[model samples]
Target chain A: MKLQINNINKSFAGSNNGQSAVEALKNVNLTVAEGEFVCLVGPSGCGKSTLLNIIAGLTAASSGQIDCSGRLGFMFQEPTLFPWLKVKDNIGFGLKILKRSKEKINEVVDYFLELTHLSNFKEAYPHELSGGMKQRVALARTLALKPDILLMDEPFAALDAQTREMLYKELQEIWQFSKKTVIFVTHNVREAVVLGDRVLVFTARPGQIKKEFKINLPRPRDINDIEVTKISNAINQELKTEVAEAVKELEHYEK
Target chain B: MKNKLIRLAKPLTFIACLILLWQILYWLKIWPKWLFPSPADVWLTLVKGFANHTFIWGILISLKRIFIGFGVSIIIGTLLGFLIAKIKLLRETVDPIILGLQTLPSICWLPLALLWFGLNEKAIIFVVLMGTVLSLTISVKGAVLNIPPILINAGKMLGADGLNLYRYILIPAILPSYLTGLKHGWSFAWRSLMSGEMLFISVGLGQLLMFGRELNDMAQVMAVMLVIIVIGVIFDQLIFGKIEKNLRAKWGL
Candidate 1:
């Protein structure tokens, strides 16, 4: 295993002076092999993103152990590009922080900008870019660091359908080339099936692994392919009950 | 170019009309020449002061006090603000006091400053410092607090920690807000410096205004007041305004 998580759990204390705690995750265990792509899919409030955060060491797990062999990278749903920095500088931010020499930083930045096809917009700021372009810049920024494990939280969720489809093809190509182990979180079942080597379906709040499906589909799977739809439907069937349960939980809390 | 010229015409016409009105009022002899001098009289006084070098020397003296006082306030205010912002306990205890001090007018400190420094350069600079420091400190604290947490997290994820975190992320993130604070602080410092000079000092524009009053020279008083306004507008447009415009463009604000 390139990464191993054992018995992870997380809970948040209620804001109103010692009310009941919100259990976000419970007794989750998983492993990812080198260069494997795993997608986590679940209903709203299902702790999918929370688990990704825990793995990135962004949010601490309330209890559990995680073992990973190399440096990590994270891509958020929003681009999170620095508004003040130009596209090239935003891509090179991590390398600059690591105190890389100017020449090395420039070399890496140029390579990634070329990879992301953002050479034309290298001088543009985040606000000037479209949503897809901004996300591409963010992707370039993360990939420039070349972390062994990449954790992404709904990285394409905010984009339009056409833009998202194009990025999916591009991302698939990039992942095929880089072969980094990836743990991706998303709510879209079709996205999970198209992207993941294995898909882990999570239950509603206090999320646990409800089921796991191995995607035996071949490389460069189209999101619209019949095989992808079949897998997505299977996952969505599991998710439908979880969504209903989450709604019931909300109403129960209200009462 | 034509649009720009047309934009400039409105204000110029309004000013010309006001000046003509003032000259007409003077011609009516509604009050003694010592009480309400015409615009030409004020202009003549200004020209005479320039010829004698009193006007230039007075401006230089006032500017020296402003620079020194403003410089010290910026340094101390930034340090104090960062300290209070980072340390929760310090912020909790000191923030209210800073808020209270910000509300207090700069002139309110004039008496205390005069008592402490004895009506000299020290007293005037002290007043200027007091005028601006609280506002700068409060603004800096607010800027630091308002920085989006995601930026900080992104910095940390990029492997920046401790001092590097502040240098790379926090400082740049807060720069736009800090510039706004500097502009406000400068205006406060300018006002405080003028008020402080009016009572104690004898070598500044403020003192020149007082001297004209003592001699009942309304033209000279109006001349000095005009000089003060011109200086304020020039610095605001040339210095703070330019910096703010560039920063906003760079930040895509």
Candidate 2:
């Protein structure tokens, strides 16, 4: 196994609304083989991201152990590029932190930039780039780390539909280049179906793995493909009940 | 290019008109000659002072002390800020005191400074140091507190920890705000230095102002005041303004 997450649990203590504690995740267990692409799909606030954060060690799990085999790279929902840095600098940021040779850093950065097709805009600042381009640069930055496992959280969700569609193709090709293990968290069923080797459907509050689907789809799957759509519909059916459960709880809390 | 020229000409014309109005007021003999010197009299006073190099020496001394005091303030402020920001106990105990002291006028440091360092350059620089350090420290603390947690997380995930994290992320992230604090601290340092110079037997433009007042030479006093204004404008527009504009444009801050 490349990564093994066993019985992870998390609870946020003492909300500002005077609630005693809010359980975010409960007894989540999963394991992934090398080069597997797993998609985590759930309702909003369904602890998909909390699980990713726990796995990446960005957040502390209230209870449970995560045994991971290798280095992990994370991409946030936002590009989160350092505004002052140019595209090249942002891409090379992790390499520089590792104190690699200057030439090695430049070579790795340049390769990633080309991999992400951002070679022309290497001199541009983050603000100067479009949303899609910024996310591409963010992807390049993550890839430059040469991570053994990639943890992405709705990275392309902020982009427009057309850009997101193009990115799906690009991301599939990019994933094929390395075939590294990936844990992608997203709400879009089509997105999960298009990218995931196995799609894990999570339940509402105090989330647990409710269901899993193993995708036997061919390489370079399109969102518009009938097979992808059929799988997405099945996943959507599983998600609706969890989403309704989440909404009902939200309504209760608001009252 | 034309628009830039026009923008520049507008301020120049407004200043010319103001100077002309002052000349008219002097011609009207609204106040006694000793009390209200004409622009020509003030200009001649400025010319003579510069010719003899007295005003030039005063300017140099004042600037030298400021560079020393303000430079030291940046070091102390940034260190203390990091210390306070990292330690919760210090944040609770010392943070409030710094905020309260920042509100207190810088000139208030003069008497205590005098008592501590006696009548000397050290005392004056101490006042300047006191004037600036508190606010600069506050600015740093604010920057630290306001850092988007995502950036820190990104840094750690990227294998930047300990001093490497600060060198790569935290320092650069806080730079724009730190520059802003430095600019504010500079102004306070000037105020504290002036008040200190005036009270002590100091060789500075503030001393020149006091000398002019003692001699009852309104022209010399006006000349010294003009010098202070010119210096203030030079630092504001040419130095701080230029860097701030570039930083904003480059960083999109």
Top-scoring candidate (TM-score): 2
**Taking the tens digit of each residue's C-alpha lDDT, what string does model 2 give over A1-255?**
389998999999977877879899999999999999999999999999999999999899999999987989999999899988999999999988878999999999889888888999999989899999999998999889989999999999999999999899999999997988999999999999999999999999999999999999998999999999998998899999999999999998898
Cα lDDT tens digits for candidate 1, B140-195: 99899998887788777777789988888889899999998999999999999898
DockQ measured for candidate 1: 0.69
iRMS per model, in Å, is 1.1, 0.8
TM-score of each: 0.96, 0.97
Candidates 1 onward: DockQ, in order: 0.69, 0.78
Candidate 2 CAPRI level: medium
Give candidate 1 misplaced runs (Cα > 4 Å). Answer: B1-7
lDDT of each: 0.91, 0.92
